[model samples]
Target chain A: MTADDPVRDSLERFIGKPMGEGAVAPEEVNLPMIRHWVDALDDRNPIYLDEAVAAETRMGGVVAPPAMLQTWTMPSPVIAGIAERGGAPTAMKSENVVTALDAAGYVGTLATNSELEFERYLRVGDRLKTTSALESISPRKRTGLGLGYFVTWITTYWAGEDEIVGRQLFRIFKFDPSTMGGAA
Target chain B: MSAGTIHVGDELPVFELPVTSTVIVAGAIASRDFMPAHHDSEYARGQGAPDMFMNILTTNGYVSKFITDWAGPEAMVKKIAIRLGGPAIPGQPLRFSGQVIAAEDKNDERVFEVTIRAANDLGDHATGTVVVSLPLEPSS
Candidate 1:
């Protein structure tokens, strides 16, 4: 859409706002979940499993896989509800951003890409908090699925107030479900 | 496995996962991603996906697994970036393979960067790069 379009104008307002609550993991950064992740993916890294092997490394302790950045802060029903009801969960008001797009006839949603940079590996007991903001919302564009807009968000994973453990730039496409007859 | 030993162009062993509807749904739940497109094949079909497919989180997890498995536990994955090329359609097994595209020394530590790809018969499911930190020598 154009800059003057109400949808774009309203969405633009949320560009620098916090996306959601400081999502807390249901559990801590521990071995069980890390083991489960490795099992699911069949990863046999000794550093993640074998204590002796991990001890030999400089990490001196088992560290969670870096790719678990988003998994550590998954959205729960409560968060979804907050978004649906237009509640301000946090600074990057994703719910408002998404709701605005939905009202504009972009209902179908799909994650397109994710790029993560880690400053350090996540170790056990290292709790995380993420702060994200709407980076940009693209005008409607045609693709294999259908016509939709690309929404990008930048998220920073923090271990504490000043320790930035990682940052992820994620993108998603919101389209109309009616355009479902084409190739994926 | 230490960073100093891994040379550029070293190919990592292939890891395979036989895709299935159950696997797809289970992965979706594990990652707490319930977008109907991942669990409901009918809904997914209605939304234009061939059937239930793997989510990006699962793909990212697999990518991490592939890298760490090859780099050994000692290798610390400092970064992993991925782009989805296609869906991991059910019944099509995914094969993951990678090559060390770059290696260098950083602060007396070895840093190895790999370009990896996961694919099925339909096409590539994901392609990405992983950066890991390793000691100069394997610690026996």
Candidate 2:
């Protein structure tokens, strides 16, 4: 239950620090991705694509699905050898807490929570950028999967000269699979 | 489904999604999440997942749709907070259900908190609260 290792001591330094540099959206909010999401999920919300219907509603125009907030800034992937890199969209940077945890033997990652808050709906042509900060890291504890630490981070999405658009607080459990002895 | 009509404890219509590789892969690609466990079954098995599963963005999308489908287009989602569990794998249909847990009047809008759960045979894939608002009608 105690996380008194040197690695744990090092991790505490990351709390409240920037995870990395801010990332700009590869593409501005556009119709294509919205349409794709609508068809893929079978979501028929007229406000998402039907401009005429949306114009009559309170929105006054088509707005991207609020949940698509995170998609705008996803790093473009390198298709080849992605699985070998453990499904990371790009090569891992050595300085972040995630890489540090993996290096310290907490090799399994499980997403446990997501809290998304939108300040305003997004319109087409709105470009987004995200800045993330490490919020907290819990001490080692026993979980259903094994022994792990709970890592939480907050990402803020911004658009058009410092106007806040939304925010997401995401949490993951990074555990050591080899520690699954009796729990397994 | 106007601001005047919504009440605490009101249930939203149930929605059932037929999970499939197509669903999983389409959502993953649309969200630009290229993680292999969401698109490659063999890779997922190697990672110890039952199969390629639904990604979190897709789950949030479905959760958003479920609320808007019932609350109508005028509703705006303010927040969606959920705790994830179990995998939403192919061949199992994920059933979506929800209820208005609290409702209050804010300036120019009526805010409502909805508790939702998306479950399949494996177990509850996601469970949490979504906060949404609808414009209040102007006084005549």
**DockQ per candidate, 2 decimals:** 0.48, 0.72
**Against the hidden reference, what TM-scores do the models get?**
0.85, 0.97
Error of 1 at B71 (Å): 1.5
**How close to the true structure is residue B78 of candidate 1, measured as C-alpha lDDT?**
81
Off by over 4 Å in 1: A1-6, A78-95, A177-184
The residue-by-residue lDDT of candidate 2 on A55-158, one tens digit each, is 98888899999999999999989999999999988886648888889989999999999999999999999999999999999877778778878999999999
Tens-place lDDT per residue, model 1, B1-140, is 66756899999999898988877877766666766767767767876679878888888878887777777777777888888788997899999999999888888678888998999999888888888878886665
Model 2, TM vs. native:
0.97
lDDT of every model, 2 decimals: 0.77, 0.93
**Model 1 C-alpha lDDT per residue in residues A1-184, reported as the tens digit of each score:** 4754566666777787866656656666788878877676666766676777778777786778777777777756444543344222333444667777778787777777888898988888877778888888887677766877788888988885678888998888988766656553
Tens digit per residue, CA lDDT, model 2, B1-140: 78988899899999999999999999999999999999999999999998999999999999999999999999999999999999999999999999999999989999999999999999999999999999898222
Worst 10 residues of 1 chain A by lDDT: A82-91
Q: Which prediction has the highest TM-score against the true structure? A: 2
Candidate 2 residue spans exceeding 4 A from truth = A1-3, A182-184, B138-140
Chain B alone, candidate 2, TM-score of 0.97
